[model samples]
Target: MPGARSGGSGGDGSNSGSYSGDASGAVTVWEVVSLLGKLLGTVVALKVVLYLLRVCLAMAWKSGGASHSELIHNLRKNGIIKTDKVFEVMLATDRSHYAKCNPYMDSPQSIESLVFNSFS
Candidate 1:
């Protein structure tokens, strides 16, 4: 009787739908909860992807060894690099000029072909 007005009800005389403060509050609360749930889910998914990436890197590291190809494979497989230019450079340059022994080793070798020019 408080919210009811007399004449414009439905044909059966039932009151039309009405909005209440409590109903609006409930809707707002549910909206906030749903947003927070989505945000948290996204964060969890990102963390899982990163964890998987780290695991893949560790596996590749264990299987990786000395050799230009293996080194490049490890670098490419673990997402350390995204371009093919590294391969071009490695292939274009001869390691024998830089490395005295272990030319195919992954570690850096001392420069054996340095040309010192006296500019005095």
Candidate 2:
């Protein structure tokens, strides 16, 4: 069949669909499947490692606080909110009113779940 490899000998006594690095000059179907499975596993493992690294880097900037003003103060101290105007604005805004959880933590928060769902 077209695009299919047969692991058998041809009419001229030559190996058909033979893979390299084997003295038998023939490759089994199970070997090909196993090799593909290993390749897929490696790719998935690498993706998981990359995702964990990204999460760690994002959480590195987080500075927990007790309240809105304290959170803004921490941000300024950490050189995130450089200008006084920005600091005042952030202080005036109550994160608890918008964020569903961890309002004082310096991290991205979703104000409304529906908004994100709409975008998706």
Candidate 3:
């Protein structure tokens, strides 16, 4: 036992590239899928809510002027303000009404509102 080697193991290996730990860090596939799903859900929810709001708004009327004040419209009608811009945007689709001022949309469209009561 005088010529015996000690602690010798097969050190043969087959790799020649630089190495580092996996960069996945903390996030998982499920996490990625869930985040994407949440984003999609948010987009869907926003579209649905906006659609419903537009539908509801279309079905209703504004008692008070929204963007333009009632007084401004009156001024326009009386040619004090001169509603050329309003006439332009409004008459873009309505063509024939280009020169005419919308008494309703100009002052504000008249609308009926449905208020839901949550009485138990």
List of clashing residue pairs for candidate 3: 61-111
lDDT for position 91 in model 3: 34
* Every model's TM-score: 0.33, 0.44, 0.31
Top candidate, metric lDDT: 2
lDDT digits (tens) for residues 1-120 of candidate 2: 898855587978886754665786588898899999999999999999999987675452566688888888877886677798998888888888778888898888887774576589
Candidate 1 structure quality by residue, lDDT tens digits, 1-120:
798767757889665668544634466777789999999999999999999988765553342347756666665676654678976676567665566777665555676354332222
Q: Name the regions of candidate 1 deviating beyond 4 angstroms.
A: 1-75, 78-81, 112-120
> For model 1, how many clashes?
0
Poorly placed runs, candidate 3 (over 4 Å): 1-26, 60-120
| Candidate scoring better on TM-score of 1 and 2 | 2
| TM-score head-to-head 2 vs 3, winner | 2
Deviation (Å) of 72 in candidate 3: 24
Top-scoring candidate (TM-score): 2
Off by over 4 Å in 2: 1-60, 114-120
Candidate 3 residue 21 Cα shift, in angstroms, is 14
lDDT of 3 by residue, 50-78 (tens): 99987665442333233335534444454
